[model samples]
Target: MERAAEAAREGNAQYFLNLGDDELIKLCQKRDEDGRSLLHSAVVGGNMHLVQLLVERCGNERINSQDSEGWTPLTSAVSCGFEEIVKYLLSLGADPNSTNAQNRTPLHYAASKGRVPIIKLLIEAGAKTNTKDIAGWLPLHRAASAGRAEALRELLLHTSKPLINARDISGSTPLLLAASGGHQAAAVLLAAKGADVEAEDKDGQTPLGAAAPHGQLRDALVALATGEKTLDDFEN
Candidate 1:
């Protein structure tokens, strides 16, 4: 099974072709010690061709198959920023909202990596914008916490009703997370999109208040919150 997985990772299509169709089916169904299928290995390898080949032989049922960490091929692809592989997997009936053991979806991974295209793609593929992970964080929260302004923008735009001020397990909104992380541009974007600057976390730390001691752009965040500055002002 490890050899087959390695072959898939190496994009050695001939390896599978050499095996009879029945043998290939068994190989595809086999799992490694970690419970990862050939599809998972193919995705981790960033080989879209191998992924397609495996899916074609194993059927789409394996597209959403989860490994030990509960990461599916789609999540793995999104995490690695393989936009083409992600799209192909989704088209092959991969569930965009499929959760791992931590309840983290592909959207969460994409947002964290700042993969704007993958974020947009997953959202369009029916990924729930408000889906929370084990940490009670939505994809928006992940984007903000990662300081991914472009990814946050794409998420907000695609979401029908974005929970701009939604709280995570830490009681922190996207704005609060962005501010605490010193993501000035992300904070500005959240503010422009109706995020509440005065919203507090479990520690009663408002966005600007949370940013004051740690972030270099605390003043700019305050100005943006108070309408003293616009997002365009930061572009200059």
Candidate 2:
């Protein structure tokens, strides 16, 4: 196990790869002060070949395995913008819905980064649109809050109705997050899906109040304020 770690540090790729799966498995199990797998190091090093070798040999049962930080291989790929690796992990049946320590799924990461292709692929491959993270913010809220217009639009196609006004831990709805982030297009979509323009957060801030500071978002806020949609329409 120590040898593998040394090999990794010394950049001895062949020595590390030549180690048997049983030996590698033991090393993979070994954790740093903060837990991270050989897979984590492999991915972090951008060694796609090594990642594939590890996946094929060690097995794909825990393809989405997390380190001490609760980040999966898929999450890491999304964070690093490794689109090819992301697709390969999904093909290996990685659980898209699995959250890390932060309770954020791959969809949230993809949406937050505006990785439109990754977002589309994840949704098509069965990622849930409305799953909440640690913050209780849905994928929609993350996308809208990050101003990921295309990702939000792509996500909408999968669900006819995805709790548009679902509140997070802070009692801020998707509309509120989008408005606060000055995401005009996202605010409009949330409104069309029946988000309450008048909904308030713990601080008594409505979506309009959140968006008032942004010139582009103000128009969307005004439109939603005038629309007939109400929170009652979305009540479960």
The top-ranked prediction according to lDDT is: 1
Tell me the spans in candidate 1 whose CA falls farther than 4 Å from its real position.
160-162, 214-216
Residue 63 displacement (Å), model 1: 1.4
Write down the TM-score of every candidate: 0.94, 0.81
Note the Cα lDDT for every prediction shown: 0.86, 0.76
Residue-wise C-alpha lDDT for candidate 2, range 1-236, written one tens digit per residue: 55555555444578766787688777766655556666666666566777787777777766777878798878888777778888888899888888888888888889888888888778878898877888898877888889887777777677557377788888898888888887777777777667787899888999888877987566655655676444243332
For candidate 1, the per-residue lDDT at 12 reads: 82
Q: Would you give me the overall lDDT of model 2?
A: 0.76
Residue pairs whose backbone atoms clash in candidate 2: none
lDDT of 1 by residue, 155-202 (tens): 998765548988898899999999888887898888877888888888
**Model 2 spans with C-alpha error above 4 angstroms:** 1-25, 160-162, 224-236
